[model samples]
Target: MLNIYKMYSEFLSSNIPYGGQYASVVKLLRSAKREILKLIKTFLEKDEKKPHIGKHFVPPLMDAVLADYARNFPDARESEVLSLFAAIINQYKVAMKDEVPRIFESVFLCTLEMITKNFEDYPEHRLKFFSLLRAIATYCFPALLQLTSEQLKLVMDSVIWAVRHTERNIAGTGIKLLLVFLNNFKKSDFCNQFHQTYFMQIEQEIIAVLTDTFHKPEFEWHVMVLQRLFSLVESGSLTEPLWDASTVPHQYPNNADYVCECTIKLLSSAFPNIMENKDLYGEEAAAKLLRERQRMLLVLGLIAPKMTDS
Candidate 1:
C-alpha cells in the first residue's frame, strides 16, 4: 500500500529538502492511476450531483497520488514512460465528457512545475509536454473540476513560458494553452506579474510578430489577449491596450492612420461615454470621431494641414 499520508505530509512541509524522492512519488502516482480512472468512469456514468466542494479544493487521496508521482520522475525511463503519457492524453481527450480531472491532483500540478523548472534543459520533449498540457482541462476536467485560482495561474505561467517558437504550430499550441488559462484567470495578479516583466516585452517588443500571425486567416487564431483586455475593461481595470496607434508595429507598417483610427475606435468603445463627456477625451477629439465615425479623418485633419503653414 502507498504511504500516501506520509508522502503528502512531506510535500506540504515547507522544509527545503524533505528527503523528497521521485521514485516514491512515481510509485504513488502509478498505484492511484487505476483508481482515478475508475472514479472518473463512475462519475461519467452517474447522474449529476450538486458539486460537493470539500474543505480543501482537492481530496486527500488525489493529493497523495500527485505527491507520490512527483517522486518518480528521477528514474523513469523515456521508453517506459509511454503508458503514463498515453493515459494522461487519453484521459485529457475525454475529460470534458467525464466532467472531472482523470489524473492525480499533485501529479498534474507537479508535472507543470517540472516542465517549467527544466524547460531550458529539455528542448526535445517540449512539444510532447505541451500537447499533454493542452489536453489538461479539455481532456480531463474531473480532477480539474474545482481547480483553485492559484493552481490555474501556475499552469498558465508554466505553459506560457514554455514556447520557444520553433514552429508556428508549436507557438500556437503554447499560446493557445495560455489563452485557456488567461480566459479563466481574469483580474488576477498573473496579468500584473506578466506585465511587470515578460508580457510587456511580448506587447512592447513582439506585437509585430503576434499581430502578423493573427492577420493570416488560415491561422484561425483567437485574438484572446484582446479578449482578456476587453474583459478587464468590462470589469473596469484595463480601458484599452497601451500601444500607441501610430507607432504600433504592423504588417502594413506604412498605414499609421489606420492604426490610429483603430485605436481611437477601440478606446471609444472600451470607455463608455468618452465622446459624450467633454471632460474626458475632449468634446472636439471624441465628438469629431464618435459622431461622424471618421476617426482617421478627424485625427489626420488635426495634424495634417498644420504642415501647410510651415
Candidate 2:
C-alpha cells in the first residue's frame, strides 16, 4: 500500500501525458483504491472492533490518495475525477465516519475552489459540481460548522451564486445545500451569521427574484427558497425584521399585512393561469405551480395572526 501511495504521489509530481503514462498511473491508483475499499468494507460488514482501520488506515489513504487527486488533478477530465471523488466520499461515509470531518475539510475546500474558479470552463459539469457540494453539506456539516467566518462566507456566496444560476438542476441543488445548512444550525445562529455576512443582500435578491418570477414557470426554485425561509420564521430561527415589511415592502405599512396581500395577489394571478393551461403546461409544471402557491398561502396563514389593520 505504501509503495502504491509512493507511486501515485510520484506520478502526480511528474509531467505525465494524459494518454499513456496518465492512464497507467490511474489504473494503478484504481487498483489500490479497490483494495482499500475492500478492507474497509470488510471491517464495516463485520461490525468488528477496528480502531486501526478508522484512525490509522482510512485517514492516511484519504490524505495520501483522495486529497492528492482533489488538490493536484486540476487538468484531469472533470467527470472522471468527480466519479472517483464521489466513490471515495461514499467509502468514507461507510468506513471512516469518524474521519469524515477531517478528510472532508480538505476535499471540500479544494472542490469549492475548483468549482468557483473553473465553472465556466466546464459548464456541462455545473450540476455535478453542485451535487458534490450538496453531498458535502449533507455528510460533513460538522466540518462545515467549524469553518471560519470568512470560509463560511465564501461557501455562502458560492451557494448564492448557484441559486441564481440559469440551470434549474444547479440552482435547485444549490437550494438543497442551503436547506441542509439551515437544518443543521439553529435559525437564529444561522441568521446572525448571515446577517453579519450577506443576509441583507441575499434577502433583497431573493425577494426581487421571487417577485419578478412568481408568475412564471421557472419560479419553482425561488418558491422552494421561500418555503425554507418560512420554515425558519416558523421555527423562530429567523426574526421578523429580517424579512418583514421593513425588509420587503408590500403596499401596506405593516409587515404581516403586506405579506398577506402579496400572497393573495400571487394566488389570484397564478391560479387562473394554472387552471387555464393545466394541460398545456403538463402535470409536472402544473403540480409545481400549485405546490408553490399552496406553500405561499401556508406561509401567509402562519403570519396572518400578527398582521395589524393599519
Candidate 3:
C-alpha cells in the first residue's frame, strides 16, 4: 500500500522521541514498525529507483532504535542486526520500490559493521543479506547504469576480502555482489567496446578467489558460491528466448543447455530452486515434476534445519 510508504515517510519526517514523552515514544515506535513492514513489500515490487526509501530514512531510523536499546541495555552484545536488516530486506520490495541501489549502498556498507562486532550472531541471515544485495544490483545498476569504475573497484575489493577471511556466509554474499557487478555489463558502454571487454576480465578473478576458497572442505558445501556462477549462467540462458526476438538485443549468445544442466545439478546436488518457476515442469512431466518437489523439499530442509544440536 502506498499508504504504508507515506506513513513511514511521515513518521521519519517527525521528530523521534517527540516531546520526550513515554506514551508518544511507544506509539511512534509501534506504528513505525508496522509501516516499515508494509513499505518493504511496496518497494520491492516496483523497478529499482527506490526514491522514498534511502539513507535518509533507513539509517536514521536504525540509529535511533539501536541507540535507545544500547542506552537501556548497555550490555547489548551480539543482538539481531541481521534479523532487523533481514526484516527490512524481506519486505524491501514493497518498501524500497524506486530506491534499490541506494538501499544496496546502505545495506552492503552497514553489514560490514556486523563483522566488526559479532559476526557469528548473523551467520543465519548472512547469505540472504547477500542475496538481497544482488537483487538490488540486478534491478538497479543496469537500469540506470550508475555504478562507476571507482565503485566497481571498491566492490571488487569487498569481494576479495569476503572470499579470503570471512565465513562461508560472507563469502557467498561477496560472490553475489561480484556477480551483480559483472552482470552490470548489460547496461555498460563496455558492451559495445570489444568482442569481450575488460569488464569480462573480472570473471577470472572471481573464479580464482571462489575456487581457492572452495578448496577448504569446510566451505565447500556453500552452494551460494557455486550458485553465484550458476546465477550468471542461468541469467544468460533464461534470456536466450528474449534475445531471439528481432527488436530485442542479441549481441552475444550464451549456451542454453549449459545453463539448464547446471541449474538441474544445483537442484539435485545441493540448493533446490524452491522459489523456482512454477511452469518449468508441467504436471505431465513426472521426472521434471519430481525434480521440482525435490528442490522444494531441499529448501525446507535447509531453512528449517533440525531444532536440536544432534
Query: Which one wins on TM-score?
Result: 2
Tell me the tens digit of each residue's lDDT in model 2 across 1-310: 5456556555644543454646776666656655654554455445444545445655565566555556565543233334444444444553433555564565556666666664365564466666656666666555666667877777788878776665666666776676676666643346545543444455445655566643244476566666765555445544434443355443343334434455556655756776566578587887997777667666656536544231
Per-residue lDDT, model 2, residue 119, is 39
Each model's total of backbone clashes: 18, 0, 20
lDDT of residue 112 for candidate 1: 54
Question: For each candidate, what is the lDDT?
Answer: 0.46, 0.56, 0.47
Candidate 1 residues 154-248, lDDT tens each? 65455555433535555667767666555544434445443333333333212333445432431334355545544543454433343445765
Deviation (Å) of 236 in candidate 1: 9.4
User: How do these models rank on lDDT, best leading?
Assistant: 2, 3, 1
**Model 3: per-residue Cα lDDT over 206-307, one tens digit each:** 444544635354244334445544564555623333222454334434634443543455445443454465566667698876677667666655534453
Go through the candidates in order and give the C-alpha RMSD of each one to the true structure. Answer: 13.8, 10.8, 18.5
TM-score of each: 0.39, 0.56, 0.38
- Indicate the residue-level lDDT of 260 in model 3: 52
* Candidate 2 lDDT trough over 10 residues, lowest sum: 76-85
State the local distance difference test value for candidate 3. Answer: 0.47
